[model samples]
Target chain A: MVESVEGHRLKLLEYEAKEYFRRHGIPTPQGRMVTTPREARDYTAELGKPVVIKVQLPVGGRGKAGGVRFADTPEEAAEAADALLGMRIKGLTVEKLYVEEKLSIVNEIYLGVTVDRRNKAYVVLASSEGGMDIEEVAAKTPERIVRHLVDPINGLRSYHANLVAKRLGYGGRKMLQFAAVIESLCELALEMDAELTEINPLAEVGDGFTAADARLNVDNNALFRHRELEERLLESYRGELTEREMEAKSQGLTYVELDGNIGIIGNGAGLTMATLDTVMLQGGRAANFLDLGGGATPERIGEAAKFVLGDERTRALFVNVLGGITRCDHAAEGIVAARRELGVEKPIVVRMMGTNEEEGRKILNEAGVETLGSMEEAAKLAVKLAEAS
Target chain B: MTRFIDKDTRVLVQGITGSQGAFHTRLMREYGTRVVAGTVPGRGGQTIEGLPVYDTVVEAKESHGVDASIIFVPAPYALDAALESVEEGIDPVVVITEGMPVRDSVELMARARLSGTTVVGPNTPGLIKAGECKMGIMPAQVFKKGEVGVISRSGTLFYEIAAHITRVGLGQSTCVGLGGDPVVGLDYVNVLRWFEEDPETEAVALIGEIGGDAEERAAAFIGDGGFTKPVAAYVAGRAAVPGKRMGHAGAIIQGSSGTAESKMNALRDAGVDVGELPGQVAESLKELL
Candidate 1:
């Protein structure tokens, strides 16, 4: 799994994640993200029962943070939405609320499927004790959790799902129903290219099961194959991007904003991270994390340089590149072009090596940009320059 | 003797017609790796850089006696390409493609495990046996032939440390890039074990980043005392923020689990000399040696 330019998984909202469950034939609480109190009231009135108003923020632990509330009446639902709409949880503002009919939960079970990297297989985790904290349950009552590794070639078979359900103390019709949920979850995970798909608290209501909450993280790398999913993700993330971030996204560059004086740019993620660490170690804080990626052209590098140095907070720039697939000359040319066009006054410390190093250094020298040979020296110079400015 | 690839390795380049594949194939060939053939479906009988091209791994193996396959397929097609090599019973398959889906990589790993085929990466620079043979995108100029074995999870960091080792007049037996992805083939433990068994490798330079417990597990394996080779490590991402992925899919601080501090402490506890910076690795290795 390679990180997208944005870094980390694109976490789907509760409503969004549940939609996958619903599409996969798993029973999920009927819900939709409502922006206003009127929409919440309208949805609650249609349900005609006690509903849950959950603040839709892309973070976990909303239940304990007062982001979730039960509304018995339409008016209560509207009030819950009003109270939650403008609230913030985990630094993310709650602009929407997922309104769903509340299920009378007799039992809560947890089921999750993810790649077991060390074991090199797909691990399906099931626990009878759920809804609260699965980690706590695994730690306190380890036997309550049943772990099974699915064979990659054969995938999660019906028998395997039945075994998981049987281990969780389900038998007869209930066992069959629970097994279906497991099978559906597996299918959803496989079809969606999901890195992690979890149904925490698969509530037992009367005779059937309802997915109370779900967490689905699709692989960003595979998003190219899922155009509809990508469009949906973009629709969900419409208002989340800053103006600069959106521009970087348009250019297909990974740029993460930070609060510092030095702008950091590198070719690879690992190298960029190491540059950040070196800058910090030398008493310089990084203003952003910008990766040019492999096989970046001179034009792309120049665009990245302009984008990063455009930030007003940046007093100095550190361009650390160890070119393998990416040629150092291309990166150098880009930096030179950015400096000329943007008329950047900040001190730009560049450290370049490997793959056309001599030509890259010559280009930088001709552009009046002194390049350093070592990462440590370059980082120190950048920090000193930032402090001087 | 190197554990994976050597001069005799008859390499097959998957996706040989692609830009990256064509470029690195020539570099590997120039570096003395026996790149016997290439595979590009529907392009069978075509030749790239004088190397014969086949439509499938089976066809390539039949005609050229392929021992290893370096896959340069795109992200979406990487799993299928790697699996094809595994099915063909390629001894060691190196995938240079990055950004493969984690689920797909997990499946590839599982299949490779069952077949006992050693897979290298879905997002890596591959590996090299110094001056003898190379199967990756690493700059050959930075590497020298000698006894120090190198294994890393980061691409650029690996090059940086290897350059330092070369500057200090040291060389490597086999330098393996375990990949920057969260799910990868040939992790730290796998390469470390091989380094321990290889008599030519007297010391090892283990480079890791924040995130994952591979380094911690490697430390545990070393702490068992069965590994006699002295190991020097450098864990990057010390300045990384919590929960932010520092480029690599696996390089992130997930709560307090995968921190640079924690990894360094673990390595230190296991009697591995840990460096604070990439350049300091040479000093640490000098002390260990």
Candidate 2:
């Protein structure tokens, strides 16, 4: 039940992932993004062939949700677009459709490069089995999947790529083509600082291969280095990141909106998440998850408080500060200040400890705000307050 | 008997002129850590808190014989700072900076592995030997000298649980934060092995959040008799939804992997006592001891 939804990475949608693929010399189906049925029909008519209309959402199971449809005629493409445009899948509205020229696929193969956290390296996974979940393939028939751990220093070398291609049962010129796609994917992953770069079902169409589906998850910390790509991919689509989430990002805070009434704020990521979990265990739901990071000053704490309190759904606020690098007094000041400034009679419960704990408690107590000693106790009281409110 | 850091460990601070670097350096020194030197790139030949600031880790190592280096450089420059220390053959290069690119962390870990240098974190509160030395940004007040070796993925949760342990008249021997990022230098297995070797550590308390298979791996290690010490654990993120990054880059339940339930079950199956809450962690460890 750990329900925080803080997406730090830039997860590019299907169309955007393919754009990177085309840029990296990997073959993909020619596609156009359309928001309306007219645009979909126009794009399909221009292609002069059957097209696949796929709704652009960050979530999976789009096919199961009927977000994917194939149309031979432009009229049918328009109808498919009309059905999908305003529909919701996995809580995300289908604002756009990706129409691609249907390709004659002979075979499907999986190729990807992702960060192996345990190994602390980029692992390239290739399999003859594709067009299905790779996890399923790995779990059910792992022997079919060939995994190669790329040396972080050496990167994905030519030998590594060739070895993976050979394992996937490709040889001669076909192996070379497969190897080339693997090289490009590795290159793209490195250049973008991507956590994951995947091509599912690398369709074999007569002469060569084409990426039928692609996913690129750029590292959040490397977003500064990829500002241009970030603006192009993230800012344009604004895929999973909401308005408040974006605003919180700008404020140097990690915030995720949940459907509960208690706004939860803590200094560190794990503690904040634990705060949310504790609230849940106490039979209360957290309205949001916010980590104030380390060494939060009074100003930053106030800013975070204001941001969390800005939500109309946040009926009560729970501030849990263990105060390692973060001073408990600063957190207390922020809570008192935000409550005073907001002037909304929302109940606030704080549990402050560690550095300057007594001072912090005094500040909150002087402000007539309730303060608890234990995180579980504070969470219980906050939940009780939220339910009462 | 102490692990990672002791009172005699010669420490150096990178990015010493920065606010966080300078602040933590003083605190580390105040807690009896021998913070010998600092590196501030262009701010070489300057002095911060009575310690000479060298332009490079090579110079600092030559001058101060620095054993460990704590990095406080910003995310963009963390890779360069960490590499400099690793190349200089500094053991246990502690990276306190958060949000370091996973690519950078991988490269750092790779280089560290080749050099036989132990890298603590790219996003961590660092490690401390209770009542002896402190190398991270954690407040020195919460910990006291005792026999429990504490390891955690989160900085504040480490403190919260450590304080609880201390409150119950138990203290930590060496508390190490494995960092809260997906790709980190040290994992639970590495720390568990070290704690197993530490003579003073009677029991272990592990604070794990939902992310990665680090805990599961630790459980496997303990189950395999790689570590025979009594262990108690508390895993957070019981309420985490799949596909959502829970604050920490590493603290996400991706698909069916990295779940709290899975981690807890693994530890419980390994004869380790698993606690439901953070407070229960110390209590469970107390019972195990």
Candidate 3:
């Protein structure tokens, strides 16, 4: 899950989205979340049939990562579960497994609803092709993808859904069923404030459609209106977040860990990113990205500084501040506080300007931290110092 | 000569009784904007900083001919504030509230489009015409009156670039922040169109970051000769790793799209000067002018 505009974006795992799908009257295969291999075997025996064990991680292309396995018996279910329980896919460990009864799928179709940022509207995308990455499909076979923009006020109407269904080659009773599913998914997306709700491979079982795979990305800013949903998914969302991410989330900071040696801290997302880019342009890699949002107090800055430096991979620290709402003197004081607190183990370079620049430079100059006026110059110095260290 | 706000433009402040609303309203007033009146839900007949406060946008609009509105209402109630202003035919509504649900923004944008009202941001620092009018939360000290028009996606970065431009003896005609959310009102295309029409704007400075194809679309617009002015652009996030969001909600690379290299190449292809750093944008613009 990524930090969104105002809060942390929560992407519900397949099992979690299926839980929501069942609650919203969308047909889905019966499934249970199991943590251990014994539980997976027990669930398979209870179902009295073949099952598919899927590792739960908030990432795409799980099947390509060998995270999905099929088992025909209870013993095979346990073996598959054992193989997947501790497996790591896309830097996230498989802490839990979802076991569901296998379906005899005759055909597959793709259906999804999401906000189209460019159009500034809600859009419904459907295709006859399924179980493939939608982006890949859109790029290779754009003609196969059918799009319908929903009216923001009136929402997804029956006629619109019917038109998309017809375009996807559905007709008669199956068309109606498919149209109803579209309407239901649209309603669900709207009600839940989902950024995206997708059902890839809406598997055809005889006459009806079952959601073979589910994806739901809820808007974190809208969580206030959804207390029940937040309560239900908060623990799982916490499990998905890394330790540093949880710390950043609690402290109202935006932090993303990366593989590098230099610790980077800056004000605003754009400046922080630009600082990271500048650092790289100077031949230095950043260990993490940290942004002190608007009105950042000195204490918050110090806390973020300490957190970034706490990483064992970070050999040097670079604090870049273009103070607008953020005060440069405050930023400088925070850097000083951090150095005093951390006992001066790492090389530090500071590029401070705007809003109390003179006072900020004075503070940093007195603290014996290397300070520079130009961002390029500071980045170069940071790269050299990090290399030397 | 400015495209959005000017000294004669009568502005209204929504959620004027709130702390952020009240504070920025004072700053706007001090910056010489004609902040005529304000609106608060139940603060009718009240006065903040000697400005009259109304109970609703309708009351404020009826009382004063509000040309534009700057909203400081919190996220949950910002949608209502914006809708009220749009329904009243406020030409440009600047939403400074962060944490707003994008769904609410989409709904508001639909109505604003029908009303022909230009909405600035749902999470924005706002816009300013140097030495003339100010809207939103950007620091007013760095801006100096000049002929260059600036459009940006980030706040502090805008200030950084603007300060650099000012230091280089080239000021600005107008500077607009298009907001930092995934969905925002008035992207590079809209502002570039306005800048092309504005007589005072001789050149343009565009500060963009990773995310969306807004920069690419702007490049296409310029490449197709939709905009004729010389544009200098600096796109952030060149070193951003794929799949990791770089602070902003929209500043992320999915698969191979929305990369800084892609945006820069597009701008360069359009015959625009694409800078390697923020300060280089000002240097390129100075040379172009």
Candidate 4:
């Protein structure tokens, strides 16, 4: 049931965003990601200055959640890295630490560029109040925030950047510099195909500015054009993937593991969610959520079935398909093939309708696979089978 | 007397040579929709299933005087196709392409608004005026001509509810999938407005899921006397865990805003009947009716 337009987006880590900033001549504190305490200590020693050790997680509110710490010495940096590496922030374990030279901030300014859904344009938001949650600022002090909508066709112009900068109370050289920064950030957002590119607390250090913290969310739909980013994402999440999930990803299937006994599979997202809801209503929990996507072939269905059946937690399998473009016969063939190839003994309940459903049901019935006419009946049977098992 | 489309509505199929375009065109034609012309860039003079194909929406409009366009263009070219229809002054353009880049959708929606054209679905099943006209990819057997108008963000969920409603002998005036994307051309408010103004539609069934403030916005609109029609609502993804996306790109609970419970509460507060299950939607609307 994956919305073809809304694919999974990947959030870049702080260090990754810093790399992009460095490439684009945007000022950012010198930083490198360290997976080990020794590496963190070495980087701190090389910098010869006080540094901030931040837990490298893709989630927000890191500072408020104790994911950010300061270290004045190499020993302290190592200790901080040790404390953060195994820490859990927002359900994700911090396996790496971004150790960067801490900068003296005279003022904190916020700069962000995101697509404004209502306006249907890219909006660049800037505020004098930074280094804090922008949402909180918007709620508490709405006057501090200034928003400028950039035309998608004309792109972000220098005048537009200056307008935003001026609104944020910048003037003269600082205004020009901030405008330049906003322009560069907009360029970076365009280059990276980002849904959001933000620099909270763009630190005003000495006579210039440096992005103290950076956040980037790359659009998943546009990821096909950016293979390197996809590779990096895969590499970063290499440790998080279960064997089945990894296999499914390789085979181009959307699979999410859940703690349940009934493995649920469907053709579309809406149908899959409804199937999950129905399973729960029938006193059953789904083991996983698997979508075969649109127009699944027999081979692809077989592969998906094999992956689900192979899960040790899965006690029964429920395949609910309301086929439109997806031919039901192909789905049936895949299920039958998986049953024979994997020799899965789990009770499989298949409910399919639309697009050659009769032929599909015939194939399933011929293979001795149970085919139900309704999703409700199929869910009840799957739950019954799971409970019996 | 459907809301947006009818048997007399002159239809143009965009990307007619494509597999989905050809398939649904035949289905729409079979269902009695006047599919006048088709647009397929290079297949201008070619005929597919006896429908004349044009190179552009302008060409199709100039020749056949098309009123509405059902787009079957791929995701990459969906914006251009929709814009083409909008530029040609088509009243409503139904885009069936999925996986369109959100940025492109934003641009297309903006242009559509400027041109005073209505666009539906960059990733949706489109719209069907039960028994009369079908512009989407939904199974035609499930819908029957009636007075209830249906709007949903999820395609399959809309079908499920439509099927249940039909099974319960509550046919629909029109059913629309707004496309389950973070950004879409039309929202619940737009559809609700149409249903409210639609003399044929007595009641409306809103199928929403966890994500975005569209449901809440719809509730607010209804509360502000925007929609006078009796509204029955069903929200999917009740079992969906937070942060984890359940199929629909826009069906994720971000913070506390887009939750099934929250949406239900909002709708209930707005004096709309809320169904606990898809099967219960018909019964819920019956209470209001």
- Give me the candidate number with maximum TM-score: 3
Instruction: Give the TM-score of chain A, superposed on the true chain A, for all candidates in the order listed.
Output: 0.88, 0.88, 0.90, 0.86
> Tens digits of per-residue lDDT for model 1 on B100-126?
888788788888888888989878888
Residue A182 of model 4, lDDT score: 96
Off by over 4 Å in 1: A1-8, A32-38, A82-95, A133-144, A166-173, A235-247
DockQ of candidate model 4: 0.37
Please report, as a residue range, the 10-residue window in candidate 2 chain A with the lowest summed lDDT: A1-10
Task: List where candidate 2 sits over 4 angstroms from the true fold.
Answer: A1-7, A34-48, A71-96, A232-247, B1-3
Interface DockQ of each model? 0.54, 0.60, 0.59, 0.37
DockQ, candidate 1, vs. native dimer: 0.54
User: TM-scores for all candidates?
Assistant: 0.93, 0.94, 0.95, 0.89
Error of 2 at A333 (Å): 1.3
Across A1-389, the per-residue lDDT of candidate 3 in tens digits comes to: 11122123678889889988888889998889999999999999999999999998877788999999999999999999999998988777889999999999989998888888788888898988889877788878889889998898778889999999999888999989889889999889888888888999899889799999999888888888887667645454554557777777677778888889999999898899899999998889999889897878899889988888788888899999987778889998888898799886798899988789889999989988888889999999989888999
* Candidate 1 residue pairs in clash (backbone atoms < 3 Å): none
lDDT per residue as tens, model 4, B58-79: 8889888998999888887888
State the displacement of the C-alpha of residue A368, model 1, in Å, after optimal TM-score superposition: 2.5
- Across A67-173, the per-residue lDDT of candidate 1 in tens digits comes to 99989999999998999998977766889889999888899999988766677677788998778666576657878888888788888899999999999999999
The TM-score measured for candidate 3 stands at: 0.95
RMSD, every candidate, angstroms: 2.9, 2.9, 2.7, 3.8
Which candidate leads in DockQ? 2
